[model samples]
Target: MSVRLQLTDIKKTYRAVTALNSVSLDMMGGKIIVLLGANGAGKSTLMRILAGLEDPDSGTIQFNNQTTDAKSIRRVSTLVFQKSVMFSLSVYGNLAYGLKIRGVPEGEISKRIAEALEAVRLSGFEKRRAKKLSGGEQQRVALARAFLLNSNVLLLDEPTANLDPNSAAIIEKAILAKKSSSRIIIMATHNLNQARRMADEIVHIHNGEIVEASAPEDFFENPKSEVTRKFINGELDF
Candidate 1:
């Protein structure tokens, strides 16, 4: 598989405390990668950098043979924030918002919106006001919005957090159904069970540094680092 994104010598800082310390990795298209880390481990920071939400103090984010702004990076990739932002519109309106922003034709918008809503199992809620939906439903709308954009790289930060088991399952099904050679799904998850079920590769971070990077099966079966082992054993703090 071809590498879709390459990070080299990446570094980010928030004042004196370094959020990322010289990290480097290559993410290829066509796989689900779970970024595992504890609180304050800088997993979110790296996702922000990859999403072009924040500039790294030092390093490179190379995509499609070019380095560009977050907006450009954003065009080929999408991020699903933990918090869902619902506008004063119906579920259909929110799902079609991204296509509208990109100036997709009305015909295409309709098709994309229908497909996305189906994927997230919100098919019949087109007329429902976004704000009126439950938390999980709202998040499903957000996921539909991102999926409608048809991005190559999808970055999710705790996508299932604060969601009920059924809602989480629906979202996971959608994610699994969409994995393809032209797409990459990277999610930061604290739930090991989710990682086991979704991740092709695992990235374990500790105190802002990558302590272990391995295939999910190997990582769970034989975690090399003490920290990673502890995490799998449910001994680490949430």
Candidate 2:
């Protein structure tokens, strides 16, 4: 039941500067794809576009083989930001807040909240103040919140940057544990090893364009692009 999300000839320009130049890529569902690039390399920009938070100057986004409005697409996508916003509330409160905001029924909310916490391996730290939690704990809270949404897609930006390896692994496990009946997960990461560990497809971006797209095995073993070669060899900083 996995479906592919397609971005066709996407272009974004800021004032006189071009941020993305006709970037086209296909992302298969039920698999993780890592977008690798340096700072200001349009990685985040592309994620934002996929999350429906930014509008491309030109291009089309098709989800599940159908073109649709951004709002509809957003309903099926979860965008986990680099810096998550935690409400001034308890961890349990934050975890269940999204369901509350969405007006889920009380019974369903309770069930979903519990399932989400379990999914993120945060079964006990419920009443703790979110602000007081460690960075990793707070991120797990966000993951729980997102999981409760049961979205079909995910867009993450540097999710493990501030997290300890243990906590990062927890979140990664959560992402990978989701039901693959119909889902897609995309992340923009600077961590090459993590990318290799998680991504099914490796998308190499530079300056403001996608230069290489390949399966993880091929991208690592036989990269075709100059930038990708330099990247795999750690010659390029990004």
On TM-score, the leading prediction is 1
Write down the RMSD of all candidates, one decimal each: 1.6, 1.6
**Residue range 1-238, candidate 1, lDDT tens digits:** 5547877888888989989998887888889999988878988998898777888888888886687666777778888888888989998888888888889999988877888889998888989999999999998999898888778889898899999999999999999987887888899988889999999999998887888999987898888999899888879765
Q: Write the per-residue lDDT of candidate 2 for residues 162-196, one digit (tens) a residue.
A: 78899999988887787475778888898888888
TM-score for each model: 0.94, 0.93
Q: Model 2: which residue pairs collide? A: none
The runs of at least 3 residues in candidate 1 whose Cα sits more than 4 Å from the true structure, single-residue gaps closed, are: 1-3
Worst 10 residues of 2 by lDDT: 175-184
Whole-model lDDT for model 1 versus the true structure? 0.86
